[model samples]
Target: MSKFVIKDDFWELFPQAEIAVVVAKRIDNTEASAEPVRPDIIELLEKANEDAKKFITKDPLSENEVIAVWRDAFKKFKTKKGARCSIEALLKRVQKGKEVGCINPLVDLYNAVSLSFGLPCGGEDIDTFAGDMRLTVAEGGEPFLALGDEEYDEALPGEIIYKDDEGAVCRCWNWRDGQRTMLTEDTKNAFLIIESVDPGRSGDLRQAAQKLEELTVKFLGGTARIEFMNINKKEIPL
Candidate 1:
């Protein structure tokens, strides 16, 4: 069973929320590809992105739009393709205005799927995550970046991210990932989050993340730690 380190603050943040986490078995020193890629993964991304576009846009974005902000990003991913082009570009469009970076296949996949699902998920290089981890909001003026290596003067507060004793393992929850804990070609241990907007949606979100987990093994040659994080409704995601 996945261990949940629950606190009273969780209920206080999300009085009517139900949250859960999904973690996969850990692997050490597994190898990833350096040749960029061929086609299969790309094709998979194309199809999965289409599915996510439909799923994410279903919600509002700002005040009342559940996933409308995703619509802006979907339009970008739908048309871009290249050895250099990446989901980092699309994320740049919707990060509520922030910087990002580029890790590798595993990290890239996490961003792509999140963009597709429109749910804003993330993955981290477990090597950097250390032993214990938790999710919480940003504290502002943290001085960070996503995958593109851009600079951040502010993260505001209430922005969800997977954090360890060090600080932020995955910033912006599902939106942007940190370069410090990115999955490189040398990355072996990976922690993934298939985030859910609410309790009822957790099942679908978790299932969708499973597909990505499968692909990680198919290409990365390592065991994985997959987690399904059910967002607490009472908690506002910055």
Candidate 2:
């Protein structure tokens, strides 16, 4: 039910980068002996605190049946809770954020992997995705999605996101689209995105995103179009 594409245009951004287009099929690795979370993933999680730390959530997923993790997360929206202040506010706390609430699987994957990698993770409705994607430095004043259909007053505009034929897939590098575009129980095919500055240290975060995609395809009976990009620094040397 999902499919992903990495356009040729995107390759220009990582021409010399040694990156891995890794795919980790699913996220229900709860067994005591299952593949322990990748080391880098754990490291990233350990680096966050406060609201940033608040991103991770526990959702019971199994390899045989990885359904919509977000379905469970919707229940929290009823509390009238919202996103952290600016990205800066979120960064300040997640270095050691204790879980304050629950979230769905896709979100939990982003948050959990984020905690260990110290990298921001996000996604959008691939079904709603319109065109080619690009990543750039933030303009700072760009508007972003807080959750669901709500938008925030801020953004990391100079940063990067998987922009499609539409303006943005989500908001550059922060929060993402609402359930309207999010993957659901009915999703048969999906598009995914995960990025970073250095591909070497980013395998785990990349893998986590893949896991979410793979798990979805299994339980939901669809396919996926996964795009793992390494947004190299324009100034960095090979």
Per-model TM against the reference: 0.62, 0.45
Segments in model 2 whose C-alpha atoms lie over 4 Å from true places: 1-97, 136-161, 175-180, 184-186, 199-227, 231-238
Q: Per-residue lDDT of 172-192 in model 1, one digit per residue for the tens?
A: 444556677776655555556
- Candidate 2, residues 1-238, lDDT tens digits: the string is 2323433343543443322232323223232322243443344333433424333342321111111222222222221233321222234443234332224433444454444444445544444544433444334454444454554444443333334443444543334443334644333234444444343445655665666565444433234434444434321110
What 10-residue stretch in candidate 1 is worst by lDDT?
A: 77-86
Model 2 is weakest, by summed lDDT over 10 consecutive residues, at: 61-70
lDDT, each prediction:
0.47, 0.38
RMSD of 1: 8.7
